[model samples]
Each structure stands twice: as C-alpha cells, then as structure tokens.
Target: MPRPASDKRERLTEAAITLARAHGLEATTLAAIATEAGVAQGSVYYYFKTKADVAQAVADGVAESLASARSTLGPEPTDALVGFLGAYVDDAAAICAHGSLLATASAGTGSDRAHREAIDWLAERFGDLGFAAEAARARAVHLLAGIEGGAALAHALNDLSPLEREATHLGRWVANASA
Candidate 1:
C-alpha cells in the first residue's frame, strides 16, 4: 500500500533534517534525502520542487520547536532571555555542526516570520525588564546575532567551547542589562 501524502512528506522532511545536520545542507542532496526517506528520487520532486523547499520546511520545523521551547521559559525576563539564547545556540549548533549550512541558510536570513516573531518575543521580554521599547528591540536583535554567530563559530571550529563561551558572555550581558 502507498503511504499517505503527509507521511511521505514528513519522511522527506525528517530525512532532510537528519542529513542536513549530519553533513550540512550543501552536502545533503535530493537523491540522498529520497534514499534516506526510502522513496524514489522523483518522489522528492513530487513533494518538494527543490532542495531549498526542503530546507524551508526544515527551518519551519526548527522555528516551531524553538518557539515551543521558548514558551516554557521561567517567569523572570532576564532568565527567559538567557534561556532563549541557550535554546537557540544548542539547536543551531546541532543543526549546523557538520559544515554549518543549515545555520547559514536559515537563521542567517532574518526575513522569515519565525525569526521576526522571535525578535518580537525577546523584545517584549526585554521591555518587561524596563528597557525602552526601541532599546528592547535593538537588544533583542543583538542577542539573536550573538546566538547565530556563536553557533556558527562553534560549528565551524568543530568545538563546543565557542558556544559555551558565547553563552556565558551573553548570559552575563543579559544579567548586567537587566541590572
């Protein structure tokens, strides 16, 4: 029996994510994705017109996961901000570690709705810490940049120390800003 459309698409997306993380997006070809998903190569085109479509789907999934994780943050605003940074860094590091293609492609482009929403969410949290609205927004962008940069650096160097150091630095900055 043939699988449902959703199931096939889901399988493709999962394969993309797994392969992208393991080998980076540039190395994750459509044929590989299809093979990994146990589908014919042409089926990949049936579900997604291009590899970039698959990448966007992966980005959407990651964004949703990140948002869900952020929703569970503790009540304190600074703590919440710090938690957000940790979540982003961890996710990005994992997703981008092989060659950092996923990170460079998805998070690097600040045009996505999920990225915008994350900025707004962080800005709101910063505002709750008594920062001016504009300042809060700016700080939110800064924090996101830090997370992306740190993750990319860590992945490129194939070391966790950069991620760790970035977390510590960002955490301290958040604390001081809140103080």
Candidate 2:
C-alpha cells in the first residue's frame, strides 16, 4: 500500500531537513532525501518540484515550530517575546551546529521570500508585545542577528558557553525592551 501523500511529504521534508542539517544545503540532494526518507528518489519530486522547494519547506517548518513554541508562552507580551527569542536562539544554534543549515538556506536561491516572511512573522510577534512599529522591527532584526552571530561565533570557536550567555543576554534585552 502507498503511504499517504501528507505522510510521504512530511517524511521527505524531515529527511531533507536532517540531511541539510548534517551535510549542509548544497549536499541535500533529492536522491539523498528519498533514501533517508525510505522512499524512491523520484517520489521527492512528486511533493517538491525543486531543491529550492524542499529548502523553503524546511524553513517554513522551522518557522512554524518556533511560532508554536512562542504561542505556548501565553498571551503576555513580554513573556512571549522573551520565550520566543530564547527558543529561536536555541533552535538556530542547534541547527547551525548540525551543519549551519539555516545559513545555507538563507544563502540559497529563492530563499529571499522565506527569509522575509520569517522576519515579518517575528516582527509581528514583537509588535504584539506593544512595541512601536519601528522598535518592533529593530528588535526583531537585532534579535535575529544576535542569534545568528552568536551561533556562528560559537561554531567557529567550538564553544557553547558564548552562545548560551548571548542567548540569555538577548532574552533579558527583549524583556527590558518589552517593558
């Protein structure tokens, strides 16, 4: 019996994300994803027309997970912001250490739209925290850059302490900004 389309697509997506996270986006081939997913190589094309599509799906998945995690913090604006930033930093750092997949995704073709949408989502989250529009935009950008920077630095140095410290500081900053 054939697997459900949604299940197959999800498996393919998970495989792609795992591959990208282990070997970087450039190494995330449809064949490899299919193999990891335990499906025929051609099956990947049925769900994702191109490698870019797979990458975009992965990015969207990460964004969705982050959004869900953020939602669990309740409706308190400051708490939500702090929790979101902390979760984002931890998630990004983990992904980066996996193979810097997020960085590779950001550099890939057709990634601009996904990146912009992710930023917009974050900005809206900040805006919901009662920040002025410009301030929310700035905070979103700052938080993202700080997380990315911290992750890269930690990776380069083979250290997790710096990333943890930076994430904590950023969380405090978000809380203060929201206050």
Q: What's each prediction's clash count?
A: 0, 0
Span of ten consecutive residues with least summed lDDT in model 1: 95-104
TM-score on alpha carbons, each prediction: 0.82, 0.79
Tens-digit per-residue lDDT, 7-41, candidate 2:
89888888887787667778788899999999997
> Number of clashes in model 2?
0
Worst 10 residues of 2 by lDDT: 92-101
The lDDT values for all models are 0.76, 0.70
Give one digit per residue, the lDDT tens place, for model 1 in 112-151: 7566778899999999999999999999999877776777
